[model samples]
Target: MDHDAISIDGGTAADRHARPGAAGAGGANDLLAHFSDPHSVARYAEGPPRFVPGFTDLHRMTRLLLTERAPDDARVLVLGAGGGLELKAFAEAEPHWTFDGVDPAAEMLGLAGRTLGPLAARVRLHQGYIDDAPEGPFDAATCLLTLHFLAPDERRRTAAEIRRRLKPGAPFVAAHSSFPQDDGERALWLSRYAAFAVASGADPDQARTARAAIDTRLNLLSPAHDEAILRDAGFSNVSLFYAAFTWRGWVAYA
Candidate 1:
């Protein structure tokens, strides 16, 4: 995805892969390729609200947690920032806050711009992975519904990079597909994930298909390992704050 003059440095695929845990493969990984489609980008806004439990409350919770450490004039770094749902929510909540949003998919970032509308003025969109983001001592950071796409090693490396960009004691919130990896439990959680989607008004087959995709594609880990990833990345005071059918959220400090 190419960036215009106003956009941040969105490096090439090789540049993205130059470092461990680097995302934004210009050549297109499966997830990135999926979002690259105009159809997917157009429908992006619909998926999260319907698939993820308590989507609105999740954004509200993220804002509250960030506000605990971030100042009124906080400069936040948001990874997986495509579509701008969370960014819009945060901007609405804290009018003074400015943002640097990173995403691998240019189409989704464009959608984010459209979604933010006038609020887009406060956000600088970067169409690349974490590596494309500015070297910042940011006030806070967030990566939600995105990390599941990476392997454990990559996730740890990415979290470490996020921590490295934070000010001392800055809050970092991450939420994604996390559940038990135990044999029986893993299958159980996945079924529940699909069931919940259906209950939330999704087509039963569509929900089941989505669940199967997650089961095959996402690198899910047990909650213990998820917390350990934060700790291993040098975050302190890690605490789990949200847990839905197949999702988990944690707030940690750098």
Candidate 2:
């Protein structure tokens, strides 16, 4: 669907603040800790529907991004590694590469560790914000479905930090959910998300509250804004690589 072409304006800050209901809130310590139990991996692997198709596209994009590089050991950093789906795939595909998964959610990290097992030895998990993460000069960096959670200023700072840690000409791919301009359309989608959250077993009230909290902190950016931020961070050859509905993806050379 050429998802990268969809550009959203306004609501960047608000979008960061709005939580995608309860499922979104699961990233926080309390909820994520419960969700990340090792035994829960079996249940989660039962093929639940993803909120967007871009979930699978990430592997393709990662391969594309790495295609030009020579077959050498590379250091990769994944910010907000979530459940480690992308990191796992990347690690399997590029055995020569070492990956570090960074996320503030200990539960998510634990789940990823258990899932990766042997491969987990090749991945170092860090719990903290991107800025606070340990020093790095990685060959590449990725932030799948995570950047939207940052405020505008934080986004810029993150871009700069990522760039600082990446080798020259390395790529940084970031994706985040955005809002539509049409108020009715936005409301309708929000309603659908609310229903989806409830169906996923999240508490309705908690879901709504979390969504509101995330909405209050979201800082969505238009394509222009995104490009500008990357450029300001010393990135070149910035390009939007994928998109679907509210999900916008970009790749920038550091």
Candidate 3:
């Protein structure tokens, strides 16, 4: 059997090909470490259900994207593509759509490589920032669960780069961490997210630490801020399709 092909039963294609005692093989710690490296697969798995309240946001976003535009044979760009979940889902839906997946984190890219399996070859992986991605006037693009990690300037720069790579009138989907403009609304949302994180199997202390890190480092913007940044980056008709707590998904045209 091809090790690159995922099994319908369980385990990744890489898992099936694993030899005994392979380096970084076996146990939940090793798996967790891999999933939580520079980027995080674990957060994606838990964030929507626990912090955001809607468990099906990603699925709904992808479905809406496909429904709006089939992406058949389209050259799609996946910015900050973690663990390849978006790539796998999109590819499965539109078999002819080719993807350029870019991420700065090595471990995340490795996870994506495994997750993609045989479909790996269909996606050209760039282990760097979006600007470093190969030439592309892509047909469409998706930047999911990213963006808010960057500061205001970097976010603007990245969005500009995305626009530069896409053809005129091309569609782009972006989902990011956000907060309500009102102070009370923001406080309430953050409190709920913290509580939800603890309830969703995260250690309370660790969750608090994570939240602090986000508060200090990540530039979680408001909905208006995001729209302004995108519009300045040359996108038009920025419309929200999904909104759950701090997570918001929008579709824009280049």
By lDDT, who's the top model here?
1
lDDT of 1 by residue, 1-254 (tens): 23242354475544544544444232225565788788989888878877899999999999999999899999999999989899999998899999999987777887888888888889999978777788898999999999887777878988999999999999999999999999899999999988888888888988988888777766778999999999999999999999998999999999
Please give the lDDT score at residue 164 for candidate 2: 92
Task: Give a tens-digit lDDT track for model 3, residues 1-254.
Answer: 12234222123435422423221123312433344454465355554455555545575665467446534678988887757778887777777888888765555666677777778767877755665576798888888877876666667888889989988888888987787858688767666677777887777986686666555555667989998999998899988888876678888988
Model 2 RMSD, rounded to 1 decimal: 10.0
Q: Give me the overall lDDT of model 2.
A: 0.63
Error of 3 at 133 (Å): 1.3
lDDT, candidates in the order shown: 0.86, 0.63, 0.69
> For candidate 2, lDDT tens digit of each residue in 1-254?
11122111122223322433312233332334433455654455332234444466667686568656524688888887746677778888888888777765555565567666577667777755665455678888888767665655667888898889888888888777655536576555556655666666666885586456434445555556766877898888888877655556778888
lDDT of 3 at 77: 87
TM-score for each of the candidates: 0.92, 0.71, 0.78
Better of 2 and 3 by TM-score: 3
lDDT of predicted model 1: 0.86
The positional error of residue 76 in candidate 2, measured at the CA in angstroms, is 0.4
